[model samples]
Each structure stands twice: as structure tokens, then as C-alpha cells.
Target: MQRIEFRKVIDLSHIISPDIPLWPGDPPVTFDEVASPEKDGYYLRRFAMGEHSATHMNAPNSFHPNAIGIDAYEPASLVRPAVVIDLRIQARDNPDYVIGIQDIEKWEQAHGRIDQGSVVLFYTGWQTLWDDPRRFINADDKGPHFPGIGAATTTFLLEQRRIAGVGIDTHGADPGQDTVYATNSQILANEGIVLECLTNLDQLPAKGTTLVIGVLRLKKGSGSPVSVMAFVP
Candidate 1:
């Protein structure tokens, strides 16, 4: 028999702080010191933030009616093989780009087909703009201007490919400027999970990596801020 060891664990989640970008009109994260070391001989703090803030996951019920909650996902389902589809070039050239079915086909041609239960993450290079909330959200009077998965592509992945879930380095799975948000609606209809606001995707290879999503097991939670990590062996 042989023993196994971890090669590396990369942090794919972003830091949750005041600087982190939040959805428009969302509540700001706050930290309060409950106890001081000098007074209580201990340090205690209380923090509060929206469930959808930072590196977070959307459960089926987040947008669906009476669907499963975040706590319902089994432990086995939280960890899965992951493939990073890089669209940095296109995203850099066009801020309002949407990853379409053609992009998925191109990736399948380069690599192998995306298997069932594999976590598919889109690398839009949006993490580079995280330092600036205005730019990261890319919003204006019209709406947001960030890259997202096209509705058709989301349908193909959730219905046809049957992937475990979809992850993005942006605000959400749908384009910010999309009024209808058909992609997100489609995912909800299928009871699909979504991981949003991911970071450090560049550190992982396009394939041959495992994604570990650590989320708070809040009962009936529509969503939860998650700590996303990658195990590379």
C-alpha cells in the first residue's frame, strides 16, 4: 500500500472586507469588536454581511421556488473535478462579452469533453479589476458591463452536459447589463448551483484540478459566502 499527500491547495476565494465589491444596493459588511483583550482577557468580534457577498455560492432556492438550500448539498457534491476555461483575451477586448456555446465547443476541442459532476469555471480576467469596485462591477446608468455566460451556453451546460455547477470570476453568471437575466433564470429552473466572485483562477490549470467549495451550513440558506480552494496533485 502507498500513502497519498496533497501537492498544493490554492485559495480561489477573495478576501471579504469593506473593499470587496458588493451588488448594487446590497448591505455593506461590518465588523464589531464585542470584547477587548484588556477588559475580558480575550478577543471577540462579530461580523455581518450579505450571504451573496464576496466569494459565495447560490443554492437552488436562491432563485427557484421551494428548491434545495445550501445545506442540502452533500459533502461529496462539494468537491469535484474542475476545468478553467480562459477567456481573458476576449474579456480584455470587450468588457460586455458573454461566453457563448461556441466558446464551450472551442474548449471541448482543445481539451476533452466536460464530464458530468465537473465544476466548470469561467476565467474572465475580471479579478484583476477587483481593487476598484466601480471597474469590477463595470456599472453605469445603463446597467453593469461585466462578462458572463450566455443563456444558450448555460442551457447547454446545465441541460446537455449535466455539469455539477458553474463558477465565474464576476458578479453573477449572467451579464450585468442583461435585464432579463435569462441565464440565471435557466440555472434556477434546473436547480443548478452557481459560484460567483471567484479569484486566483489563473493559478489552476485548465484541467486536472479539483475544486473544494467550503460553505456555511446554514439551514434553509438561499446562499452562503464560500471559501473556494483548489487541490492540485
Candidate 2:
């Protein structure tokens, strides 16, 4: 491969740490100092975290039985064309809003039909709550509430556009209340990547940004933490 040139780069990943909001039952992020300069000649630390926590990508195995893992994704496929659909106003009006086909069509009316193999992203203004776990999670007796792609919408994208997958600035690709993970499962079930907890969607335009998704090549791993970057044209 030739040396890659630089461009206006924007990071679309959340900073992972103990304080990052996590799934109700997922493993906690922890770091322990295994060696320090005071005790040893080197400074080193060990860390533990869940695959789905923080900013991450979900592979087919995450939802389907006996499916391929994160490592199976071809390197060339990881860097993909991406498009963002701004739904901040709708999400602000209703925290539990689910993006439907109509919303996607409305975006297309302005941005043109989404190209095949593109990764669609939804910017719901949720990134603003990153610092506040209380509001970011927004859980209640019912369940967590946040904006996400609807199952039917996911079906449309897969069938109509044959997109690579979808991403969101939330913990799950499905609406937070959808414990069944309808949207999340549907995408991965069809072997599409589902990027979650991404940030800086606000900085990306409706199109023209190429996504450079970085996922750990974990063998047979259901999912892996991701560092998603955008190269704006």
C-alpha cells in the first residue's frame, strides 16, 4: 500500500475509562498498576474491559449463533464511505425517538440517495451528555431511553441500499428501551457492522467523509472496542 496522505481528520470515538457509562450488566472498565517506577524499573499497567463497552463495533457473532467474529472482517472493508443523518431536533423532542424509513428518505431528499457500501450514522445530540452518566443513560423503572435506528429502518437499509451498516452516538444501535435489541441484532444478523457509542457525528457532514474504523482483531470475539476516525474530503 502506498503511503496514505492526511486530511481533515475527526475522531468519532468516546474516551474509555472507569467513568464511561456502560451496559447495566457488562464488565466494568478497570486498570491496575502491575509495575511502577518506584517499585520497578518500568511503569506498566493492566486493563480490563468489555468488548461492547465504550466506543465499539459489533460483529455478526454478537447476535447470530456460530457466526464470524470481529477478526473476520477484511481490512479493506473496515475503511468505508460514511454518511450522517442529523436528527438532533427530533431526538430532542422525544428522547426515545426511533429513526424510521421516512426520516431516512427525508435525509435523502437533501443529500441524494446514499451510496451502496456506505456506513450510515445518526447524530441525535446524545453526544452532549457524554460527561453526565445520569442523563446519558436516562434509565427509569421502564428502562433506558434514547434515540436509535428502528428495526424496520434497519431492514430498509439492508435490503434497499445494501449498506455496510449503521452507527449511532449511543450505547446501542437499537433504541435504548428495546431490550430485545431488534435493530442491533438485525444488522449483525445480516453480517453488517454496528458501531456504537461514537462521538463527533456533529462534525461530519451528510456525506463525503470516509470512515476509517479500527477494531481489535480478536479471534472469534463477539465484538471489539473501536476507534472510528473520519477523513473528510
Candidate 3:
């Protein structure tokens, strides 16, 4: 007897909610009902939260001076072919691991060159322990210990590959340990974007996928929370 096979697809994005861990100092997400059928004629609710609360987009103005506003960013830039480069091995060994040139080289050696205009998503496997504050932040006397793209690697992707942007499964594009926000500053200055607080990347194939980031059109806003999704073929 012969068996038939079917393609399996997985979503590689996080669900944003009030309980999702947010960066310290940001206001907590709030939801309140303004009217209800029991009290009035209909039901209506209101929400209040920072733009950068959960899975979100980062505009040039986020770190650069007088950069493009979040609203002005082209919608076309939000969707693109993507490549997932796994750094879980290094991250497991070093919680503060920074994705570097060597990592890119290794990936290219196996998967060929990362195409220009691709949205490179780095998988640190940090999302697995996101619920634990201690493990998520790994805060200490020095600072938080989380993984992110190194300055050199980010620069290389921007200058060499001319990538559209970068994404990560961690809280920020810059590591919790980065003091200068080097990668963020440079990337934004170059008109490159960053998608942060992503999850479920382990379900995606390394290549042959597309990432769609839906950002709210906030007038003159620096950055905003985004509804992210991945399409696999």
C-alpha cells in the first residue's frame, strides 16, 4: 500500500496579551468596559498601553534623531521574505550571547547567502523560559543577560546584505546586557527596522517563508505594537 503525505505549516509569531512580560518602566496593558448590555444598550471597551508593549515594530525615530515616524514607514517594508538563523546553541552556553559574523558565516555555509531585502529572524530559544522573570531578564548586579545581535553582525547585514530588517524572539533587538544600543542606533539610522518580542520561531523552516508585521498607524509615533505572522510554503 502507498501512503500520501501533506505539507505541515506552523505559525511563527507570539500572541500579545496583558500578561505578556513588558520592558520595565512601560505602562501595563489595561482593558476596561465603557458600556455593557447589562448596564446600558450595548457593549464597548477601551484599551490603554504603550506602543512598544509587546510584539512590536521599531521605527527609525526609536533611536535616531529626527528619523522617520512610525506612521511614515512604508507598509511594503513590513512584509518580506525571511530567514531564521538559530543561535540556540550559543545562547544555551551563554545567556548573553550576541549573534556575530561567525554565526552568519556558519549559516551561509549551510544555507547559502541570505538574500538581500530579507527579514532575518534570529532564534535564541529564549521564548521557552519567558514566563520566568528571573530567567527572562537574567538580571543581576551588572544588568540583564539576554541574547541579541552584535553590533558588528548588524552592521554587516545592513551594509553587506542590505537586509530590510531584523527580528528576534527576545524582548529587544539589542541584548539586555547592551549598554550603548549600538545595533539599534545604527540600524535605525540606516533606515533598517527591528521586530522584537517574537516567539514560536522553532516551528518555522529556516528558509522559504514570509514574515508579515502589521503595525498601527500612529501619527508621529516612534514605534508601535505589531501583529506579526509568518507564511510558510
Q: Highest TM-score: give the candidate number.
A: 2
Supply the TM-score for candidate 2.
0.95
- Evaluated at residue 176, the lDDT of candidate 2 is 88
Ten contiguous residues minimizing lDDT sum, candidate 3: 2-11
Query: Which ranking of candidates, highest TM-score first?
Result: 2, 1, 3
- Count of clashing residue pairs in every prediction: 0, 0, 0
> RMSD for each model, in Å, please?
2.0, 1.6, 4.7
Better of 1 and 2 by lDDT: 2
lDDT of 3 by residue, 28-107 (tens): 88889999999998999898888777778888887877888789878777778889999999999998888899999999
Cα TM-score of candidate 3: 0.91
For lDDT, the strongest prediction is 2
Estimated TM-score for each candidate: 0.94, 0.95, 0.91
Backbone clashes in candidate 1 total 0
Please identify model 3 stretches exceeding 4 Å from their true place. 1-11
Task: Please give, for residues 44-149, the per-residue lDDT of candidate 1 as tens digits.
Answer: 9899988889999888787777988889888867878889999999999998998999999999999989998788999999998888999999888988899999
Error of 3 at 15 (Å): 2.6
| lDDT for predicted candidate 1 compared with the true structure | 0.87
